[model samples]
Target: MTDWQPSALQLERIAYRQRRARRSTLIAVVSSVVLLVLVAIGIGSTPGWPRVRATFFDPQRAWEALPVVAEGLWLNIRVMLICAVLIVVIGMALAILRTLRGPIFFPLRVFAAAYTDVFRGLPLLLVIFLLGFGVPALRLQGVPNAAVIWGGAALVLTYSSYVAEVFRAGIESVHPSQRAAARSLGLSYRQTLRFVVLPQAVRRVMPPLLNDFVSLQKDSGLIAVLGVIDAIRAAQLETAIDFNFTPYVVAGLLFVALTIPLTRLTDYVARRQGWYGGGGGPV
Candidate 1:
């Protein structure tokens, strides 16, 4: 309102105010970071700190626990791989059944729906218990031990439902024009699905499928609840024996190590397939 130019001193004062504002912002940021670091250090330095430290840094204990951890890790990998293969096979069949439209297809649809509903509705732990305890109570011969039978079966049954839906969606995602084009070439429905629709749908859905596989790998730990001696269980046993937490941390790292490759592979495929562009090409 004064309509007057500032003196040199006023200009200097304005400059000083701007500099002070920047200084205050920098101080706030640095203080917040320092506070966070202090809180983290305080938490880490709590009781049993000495043993936790020794567990990771101690080479001898690490070496001693390696073999046991490796055994459990192997079991985890085996369960995941077996479940993945079974899920792919079972899921494809169910997806095909769900898409067919006819009198024969109706019963298959009902059965697939019930199967998916039952498995997906129940928690994995309950299913594992049924397999481990209930099946044995029935005295079914040729059933292997709980570890082999329950752990493996529950993983396959539970995940296959979700993956079946994934397959169904992928199969349906193929454009009707693609089907028409294939059929125009004298390809039958099954042949169109086998050669044209499924191949493209699968490539389009690879990223999600990989993500589901990773979830299956992590869920393999649920087997330990049924006494399957997976990596988590083995780590707990080792930790109790040694009275140290290092084994558990090491076991956790092993899981992270295993999953990191999968995440990277998913990213690689997503990028290669132009996932940003709606999975337009090969992954």
Candidate 2:
């Protein structure tokens, strides 16, 4: 009876806490909105804002640029999809090469290491420039001179280097016991890798792989510099005509929109895999 009587006070306290939590959430939201508004007001009051607004935030210009920019974005989407496939394949192959054991495989291991080191160390823009410009300059017979192809190849080379390391890390992270168990079950090294080790390794590194793919999506825009006429180039053309920077903003927004979903997916995978910390954290 006494325990039942105590319940009224506890229930009231619980209700009060719930009310406070709701109020706090509302206050935080309002405060954020207020802060943003104040910042916008301050920026608007600046002397340069009128010109800046006309140039960079022009709604009419943005609307006009949308269709052309959208058309160019399709090229980017195509190139990114192609490069993503190539990167994963090349990266996985290099990773497997690096993981090979024995003196017979020494050259392969060295080559894989060198490939990753050189590409990973070089700036991606430089790689894109070299491949996009230099390849066409060579004028090799049977080689496609399309800037999109060359640019996509460059992205594959650079990103494969990075993704190779991720795959290698995943391969290495597979427990030695698991490999031993596979061997004990009469599986050959390749068979064990195919059937047991790689599957597990891939699962472990999926989040990192997704993260690299997101980066690839953004880097696809760099192809615009090669005269591929992707979103950025389209925006540039519009900007040149109208002398308004709003088209560039629109292109940027499109890229951001494309990237946000992938980034969220990466975070979701990381959380599910329990990869919550920086540098050498558990997966």
Identify the leading candidate in terms of lDDT. 2
The segments of candidate 1 whose C-alpha lies over 4 angstroms from its true place after superposition are: 1-60, 277-283
Residue lDDT tens for model 1, 140-225: 68866666667789888988899888888998899999999999999998899899999998998898889899888888888887
- In candidate 1, list every pair of residues with a backbone clash: none
- With candidate 2 superimposed using the best TM-score fit, by how many Å does residue 132's alpha carbon deviate from the native? 1.5
Provide the overall lDDT of each model, using Cα atoms, as 2-decimal numbers.
Answer: 0.85, 0.92
Q: How much does candidate 1 score in TM-score?
A: 0.78
Report the number of the highest-TM-score candidate: 2
**Residue pairs of candidate 2 with colliding backbone atoms:** none
